[model samples]
Target: MQEPSDVLVLAERHGDVLTLTLNRPDQFNALSEAMLDALQAQFDGCRDDTGLRVVVLAARGRAFCAGHDLKQMRTHEGDADYYRDLFARCGRLMQSIVGCPVPVIARVHGTATAAGCQLVASCDLAVAADTARFAVSGINVGLFCSTPAVALTRNVSLKNAFEMLVTGQFISAAQAVERGLVNHAVPDDQLDQAVSGLVDAIVAKSPLAVRIGKAMVYRQLGMPLPQAYEYAAGVMAENMLTDDVSEGIDAFMQKRPAQFRGK
Candidate 1:
């Protein structure tokens, strides 16, 4: 059962971009059941909306997120079924972010540990504050961050992800970029600005092209090299048949900006 809170997550829309901010600052915006449900609901809404071009996952307060609410987890004690259901729900939310048509950019401005770090990894892209730190530190409490490891390994090298999980050590934002965990790390004050830069660039492109490309990128990653190429080639061929692609090529030749209607 979720604890009652009017705004576990705050949603703000500016034109075509939707920003979802975690609001439980006092608790380091920990992913309580309520918070997860709030986030899941928001992503579900985005799935069907063609007008939405981008989603920025941000947080309020000092820490972006500290991970799961240990207090809530503690309440369940040794209930194995409860834990399984919880993790399953969390997994579905992460998958939803990946499957979203519009890109989800993690705007990390503070500490993101354990599942918090997993949230960042699940996004299509991320920009972090230079001072922000990340870790999969559930090992410190004698528990392995198995779920986070799944996302971590996909984003970063196996050795690096294993080290974080085993050692429970923190990595600075710049190091995160080096490890391919985040795209850019800017000064703390410029975090939101960097996120907006990505948002602006994405929203300017053809919505249909972006949607198709995002889905193709993830799907191809799971295929064998030759099969991946074949899949991509088919996707590109179909993409070329769209009016947006035709307009893009015409605009390039005509020396004019493309007026992509997302057709």
Candidate 2:
């Protein structure tokens, strides 16, 4: 497909993989109105397209994302409507990432702070380079990252999340992984390889299974133990009826690799 304006660069394919690159490297890929709009549009398109399987969120900068552009926020100071709308748009963007039918992966290479860390947590999976660092430092600037707290709280423990928010200290990639913030921490030079490995693992599965499985996992996460089991049972029953499952079962019985059409 044709690229969109270079402001929100999206490289997509039919085989269920899409890569979105935040293009504002000069400001450490900070979120801009144009970038947010482009991301919203791209994700909206992905929602409609059944062929899409996964999304890899990356950036073309030394830093993955520094968070909201303070300059932009300053420009809209005293305009309550503008601030409200801007944050609302950003929240929707993050929600889209979470609610996406396909799994979303955040590839973090450098500093991810405040809302940037929120973006990483919002994704289904995250792979960070050894050089990467994360912080929810909004409190240091007198603004609490109330919005980012939503995703952060869900991903890490209450104590861990509170520590990051309250202290605003930068945590290493290894520390992040241990705290359940990142799925994998790799050498900076091998960041690409590590991400590719993750993508390969994801794409190797039946697309429909992966998509539905991801959704079900999130759906049941907040449920009571018994209710979660009930929900999972229903999903499992439905999943067993799909053609991909049938093929997978047959392939296993026959001791051969299965070729899934993502049906």
Candidate 3:
């Protein structure tokens, strides 16, 4: 495993698992322009590297992320273009995580508010500490969490999303899991182990199959039912032609574990 860098901190790797730690603990790992850029670069690197199979997004400190840095925003509030560009960049950063070829898992250990909660919802899977809490509280500060609502609405029911947006009240990790925002809720001490277990399960699969399957799921989810099925069938057909698929099937027939080269 590589050491943590000045930008995005990294740790732990066994084969294809890459754990990315958000490093701004002082501000609860708040999303800043520099942090966004660092995250984008890391996601891009992971996309181009076939050796990487999974990404674990974990943060340092007591909060996963306090969302966008209000101080940073205040510094450019007078400049409309600056504010627009900043938010646009943030959006792109979120999209990068969503569109990465490898599956991404969010390991939340603390409060995840506003855009932070959106980050959890955007991930392919998320496991949160039982002590963790989530909220979309931009409304309390006069700014509506419109951007966060985009992800929150898709992950949960309309009523549930609206309640969080309107009330700006915090919900426990269990509530997050029950509302479909988090995949599981475990004890704080077990968060790392739980994340590792889930990543191991992902990495055990053929990388090419997992990547193609993940991409197809996101693409098809936005289309009509029939069209979605058609798209999925196309993806499956293409995936079946890969060398990994052949090896996988042959290994199954031969009663052995498949050795995939991600071809």
Candidate 4:
């Protein structure tokens, strides 16, 4: 595991599981420029590391993330370029999470509002504490959560998602799961254990298959049903050629656990 630094992002690895914690607890892990860079750089740096099977996006603080740094944004209030570039950077970071080959799980606690909720939505799967809350709340400040909406709308139903966007209302973690924002909501004390259970399940399979499946699912999301099926079929064919698939099938036949080196 890597030692925690004074920097905005903290990275730690436990075997095949990598955990990235948003370290700015005082600011509620607001998405400052430094935070965005830290997240993007980590994802970009780890893009080729196939040995990693699961990435857990966790955070420290009373709130998971309070969204963009409004106080910081005020410093450049009239600078259109700064605002545009800032949001664009944030968008790229979110996309990186979606595009990553390994599955990313958001371990959420407390409030995840505005861009923060988008962060949760950006992950492949999320395990949130029962007390955690979520919202696309930029509307309350008269600046609608447009950037966050891209991910929000994709995860949640139109009516429910729109209500939260327009009203700036927060939803409980259970409600978030009901609306497709999170996979499960467990007790606060069980947060770490719950997330680890998910990680364990993910790492137990062929890492390559999980990676391929992650990429295929996200890529096919925007395609029409016929096109999606065609794409998946091609992917299935390609996946079938991997050594892990053969080993996995043989192991099942032998009635024993498969040995996978992510080959």
Candidate 5:
């Protein structure tokens, strides 16, 4: 029940990368109201960080996140207004991750269930430990994970997403990767290394190109096939006008390392 500023989420900066760790290990890093607020604030801060190349959403405890703080929810019991606000706030947080200019990568070590799974799905990329597990298990408690389903369905096939929602069954990290919930699943000890690899690759790219590409990819996902192509073509043309793209092309032609200013 700590305040949002009391380290419900910890923001650590290393060069151009920001690592935001869920700090509620004792509660399995549950997304309490404070935690959600803290996470949103951190992502908001990233919005204007032009030098930032990547963001890693990680957790400190045995579980990555155990969805919402059920104890906190139970305390409010039949407060429909509170529930609506809570879910809306959470939805905004998830959207912020998607709308991030730089890629948001989830470094998942343990279980990520319910809304926690939604968090992973919302990230641009995710790398999980081989021992990690995932589920949208709200149904087990007689509450369907309706909000989580929005993200889950986007990341995986509808059938698989529906099965997870209805069955409330846990899937292994390997299964998660197979279903496209995560990019890679490595041994537990290699989790950090795996995440570092992704971070390094992204940091080496032109920041502007990465930003444009991330935004374009998400924006086009909901478009019709023809409209998506039309939109992407326009975005690509716009990207071609950037100084970074010019540098990239010239470097390729000259067979030299590209020095992108991210312009």
Candidate 6:
């Protein structure tokens, strides 16, 4: 199904990378129901496209994202089932970013708080501007950032994740890098160039290798060391069977650049 033309999430296809820009700057790009649906739709669209190699999740305006639309949630508040369903929907949206075959990189320009922070944590990688800030700050409003914690803890240490969840304190982009929430942070002026450079470098690689590696890394993180290696060895064996692997080896032998079909 096609989303409306006036989607809260604006998608731009530039060569092999799809940049999904979160609109609603006036609202700090809050993940309203419409925004969540739009984001999920774009992810779904990318899943079957063999030509697509990466996704750059970005947002416009002052804040990257401010979490769920408070006004919308409060409208349906006091209804247990409504809250449950809403959270479940949000979880699915976040999962799609991880589940997508292609790598997803967060192009964080400003504050990403609560569920917004979860969005950053959920991406395969993130690059933030120096002006950006992050927090799992639902606690400030008397609600613990339980769902955000799911993704946050996966990307960071237990103690670090817990402190952010409980303190409602916003951390600088540099601190985000140190805590492992983001890969790195650069000057605000360099943010766009940094994201573009990273994406360009990634899409130039064998898409098949990138796809398999990104997925395996996330999966193995949950397993015991021995089991993880076992699982990884199997993945490598399968990857080696691909035509891209053979092409890469041949190119290396020939002293030429690889032209991968991602086969």
Q: Candidates' TM-scores?
A: 0.97, 0.95, 0.93, 0.97, 0.97, 0.96
- Model 2, which residues run further than 4 Å from truth? 1-6, 12-14
**Model 4 vs. true fold: TM:** 0.97
Give the per-residue Cα lDDT of candidate 1 at 105.
97
- Ordered from best to worst lDDT, the candidate numbers read 5, 1, 4, 6, 2, 3
Off by over 4 Å in 4: 1-5
Residue 263 alpha-carbon offset, candidate 4, angstroms: 2.2
Instruction: Point out where model 1 deviates above 4 Å.
Output: 1-5
lDDT of 1 by residue, 54-92 (tens): 999999899988999999999999999999999999999
Task: State the lDDT of candidate 5 residue by residue for 7-48, as single tens digits.
Answer: 888888999999999998899999999999989999999899
Output the worst ten-in-a-row residue range by lDDT, candidate 6: 1-10
TM-score of 2: 0.95
Alpha carbon deviation, residue 29, candidate 1 (Å): 0.5
Query: What is the alpha-carbon lDDT for the whole of candidate 1?
Result: 0.94
Over 4 Å off in model 3, which ranges?
1-8, 11-14
Clash pairs for candidate 5: none
Error of 2 at 144 (Å): 0.5
Model 3 global lDDT (CA atoms, 0 to 1): 0.89
Encode model 2's per-residue lDDT on 1-263: one tens digit a residue. Answer: 53444555555564668888888888898888887888888888888788787899998878999999999899887999998898899899999988899999999998999989999999999999988999999999998888899999999999999999998999999999999999999998998899989988888889999988988998998899999999999999999999999999999999998999988
**What are the C-alpha RMSDs, in order, of all predicted structures?**
2.3, 1.9, 2.2, 1.7, 2.0, 2.0
lDDT of 3 by residue, 184-258 (tens): 999999988999899889888898899888888888888999999888888889998999999999999999999
- C-alpha-based local distance difference test score of model 4: 0.93
Alpha carbon lDDT at 190, candidate 3: 94
Which clashing pairs does model 1 show? none
